[model samples]
Target: MNSLAALLDWYATLTPASLDRIAQFYAADAHFRDPFNDVHGVPAIATVFRHMFAHTEAPRFEIAERIEQGEQAFVTWTFHFGLRGRAYAVAGGSHLRFGADGRVIMHRDYWDAAEELWQQLPVLGPPVRWLRKRFRAA
Candidate 1:
């Protein structure tokens, strides 16, 4: 299977137990960045998902779209999880580049924390919504 196919399969079915396979999918010195994390190497990258599994309830990724060209690809997905008994779906996308070895060398995720996370909080939601509406074009 191709790297993108294998990577997406791994991610779509990711579990804490499957995390050890990180090395197979990413380069030894791979870089991973997201709204809340910026880490390098297999161990550090694994820790990010470890923290995710520990802190979130039933966290999962559902791939919505994928585009590949040469050694790079971009995939759009929705991260689903529950916090404080509330379920949230965060729409995000990652830009990935593969090394010559076919392992991902860089993974950068793009998403708006303010709109996707902060605005989903019960207490913070109201104010955030207000601020967005106040500045939004009608």
Candidate 2:
């Protein structure tokens, strides 16, 4: 398989134990960003994954689609996990730019934080939903 395909497959199957292999897919100076994090370098990336594992149970990814062109690729995915003993899923996508060596240099994830996360929380869910409805366009 090609490098991009391999990388996507690896990510879809990533686990806390496989985090040590992060360096193989991301460059030393890679940059990663999502709804809540903006970090650089492989070790920092690993730390993000570690934090995910620590806070959630059985976190896993399912890649729904991938589009690649030259050194850039976009992957749509769904993340599944258990938070506070309750299962939750968030649908998102990643925009990745690879270096000449095929290691990811920039990775940015796109997702709706309010709908996917904040609106699912026990204390914040109601208020967030109400606020959304109050200001939503008709």
Candidate 3:
């Protein structure tokens, strides 16, 4: 398989608690960005991951589609997570740049944190969901 497919497959194998393997996929100088974090380097990236695993339960990453051109690839994915037996699904996409060794050198995700996750939490749950639905219908 191609490196892009291999990377996506490897990522799909990640579980909520697979910190070691997840760390392995990252380059030492890797950078990551998302709604909550705009971090550089593996250590900072791992910290963001630690926080995610700590808060999210039953996390699953599904690579729905992928395209590659040159050293960069775009992956469309669905993030599945649950908390307190309530499940939430979010569709997101990642832009990745691969190093010579095929590890991720840079990764960024695009998704609506408010609708996908923050809305599922305790205090902000209802209002966030209502707003998301309202705006989506407009």
Q: Among these predicted structures, which one has the highest lDDT?
A: 1
Candidate 2 — which residues are off by over 4 angstroms?
none
Cα-based lDDT for every prediction: 0.94, 0.92, 0.81
Error of 3 at 101 (Å): 2.6
From the highest TM-score down, the ranking of the candidates is 2, 1, 3
Where model 1 places Cα greater than 4 Å from the true spot, the runs are: none
lDDT per residue (tens digit) for residues 1-138 in model 1: 238999999999999999989999999999999988999999999999999999999999999999999999999999999997889999999999999989999999999998999999999999999999999999
Task: Show pairs that collide, candidate 3.
Answer: none
Can you write out model 2's per-residue Cα lDDT over 1-138, one digit (the tens) per residue?
228888987888898788889999999999999999999999999999999999999999999998988899999999999998989899999999999898999999999999998899899999999999999998
Tell me, by TM-score, which candidate is best: 2
TM-score of 2: 0.96
- Tens-digit lDDT track for model 3 on 52-128? 67888877788898888888888999988887788889899999998887778899999988867788788898999
Model 3 C-alpha lDDT versus the unseen true structure: 0.81
Give all TM-scores, in the order shown: 0.96, 0.96, 0.81
Q: CA shift at 31, candidate 2, in angstroms?
A: 0.4
The Cα RMSD of model 1 versus the native structure comes to 1.2
